[model samples]
Target: MQIVDHGRVSVGCHVANGWTVVEATGEMDIFTSPMIRAAIIKLLQDGHRHFVLDLCPTAFLDSMGLGMIVAITKRIQAHQGSLRIACADQRLLHIFSLGGLRKSYAFHDSVDEATREVPRHNGLGRWPRPRD
Candidate 1:
């Protein structure tokens, strides 16, 4: 795993069980959103289909940060990719829930668990899944 520490956040990435786990640490607000977005975009361009965003250490997440996640989700879906999110902070989880995003993607308890469940790719956004 290669870890790069930036001014406001430290980003780390590694491949685990065929899934790319990107660990982001620190406040994820307007100031630091671009850095994270660039990293994810690069990963996607590099042909990584499955992704896990480990936001366990995110101290704060503003609208820009949420936008980044939303944009990435769209990009991944367009490429027929999948996404998993691992966030430890209950407060931050509540923010996602409030935005009606809690059920849009799979939320895992840990990054390790997310990597193991990379094959589970539910449809993106609020689109209804076809009844089986």
Candidate 2:
């Protein structure tokens, strides 16, 4: 796991053999959302469509952050990829659920579980199987 600091925000990236887990901390409003967006996009460009974003440490999130998530989800879907979030905070979970995004993205409790759910690199050529 490697942590990259972008001033107010910190992005912790855990790269496994096939998956990449990003743990974001600090505020994710209009100002810092782009950094998160870019980081995810870069991974996508690197042919990593399966992702797990751990937002447990995130203090706050605004519309822009939510929008970025939506956009990333769409991008992943477009490529027949998958994206999940590990967020245990009730407030953030409430916002995601109330916003109707709960049905769109899978939420997990830990990075280990998230990565386990994601398929291996060889399986990326095909769309993900439905979760049980």
Candidate 3:
């Protein structure tokens, strides 16, 4: 179901199998990160752990946007939860690599694959993340 709709981005949540898929469409920058951040935090507070971030429709992700994602990931890790990102956009994938975050997080080709009961992950979790 759709959760929040802001000018720059829209956040939606759906149950796929046993996991929750949180889809974000449109640009996610400084202007929209706060809203997304709040929504994710609320989900966390509500005991939603594992997440599938369907960023297929997300067109842009600035520094603030990337930072928000990293922050949320840290929080999820703190809770022993996992996050899978589904971003087919080549630009975003390239940005993830350029930002030195490719190994820090897991990326899937589609949301369907990402929202599986178990998210794929490597044993090592020592990658550097964006600073707060």
Candidate 4:
């Protein structure tokens, strides 16, 4: 996936198996909130409720970005889906923890772990059969 720029923020998306991975870079303040929101919403609309937000490359994150994530989580939960966040940045991690988001969202140390752990659902309401 190529990096998509919305002003100073860069967002990239890719799909592996049934997980939709979104890698975000640059500042994530109010100015870049719309881009992030749009990317997430688009994925959900495309029938991709399982998400792995790779934020290791993200340089900054503000309240707007945090709110967007929380909103996405709510939407995913409504659909019986899940959202995992991969963030190795200390600053970002601290912010999430301090904001109480860590308790609400699943945080992973790596993108691989996030993607591997997200549950895959079969439209029939049961989890997809595990792979061998």
* Best candidate according to TM-score: 3
For candidate 3, write residues 1-132 as lDDT tens digits. 788897878999977765668889998898999899899889889987778889998989988888898888887777666677898888998888887887667688998777655543421244355323
User: Candidate 2: misplaced stretches above 4 Å?
Assistant: 1-4, 118-132
Q: How accurate is candidate 3 locally (lDDT)?
A: 0.79
TM-score of each: 0.86, 0.81, 0.87, 0.83
Better of 1 and 2 by TM-score: 1
**Candidate 2 local Cα displacement, residue 61, angstroms:** 1.4
Candidate 2 lDDT trough over 10 residues, lowest sum: 122-131
Expressed as tens digits, the lDDT of each residue in 1-132 for candidate 2 is 544577778987876535678888898889888888888788778777777888988999877888888887777777666667888788998877677666556788877777775464433233233334
* Clash count of each predicted structure: 0, 0, 1, 0
Runs off by more than 4 Å, candidate 1? 118-132
Candidate 4 residue spans exceeding 4 A from truth: 118-132
- Which sequence of candidate numbers ranks them by lDDT, best first? 3, 1, 4, 2
Error of 3 at 97 (Å): 1.1
**lDDT agreement with native, every candidate:** 0.79, 0.74, 0.79, 0.75
RMSD to native, candidate 1: 3.0
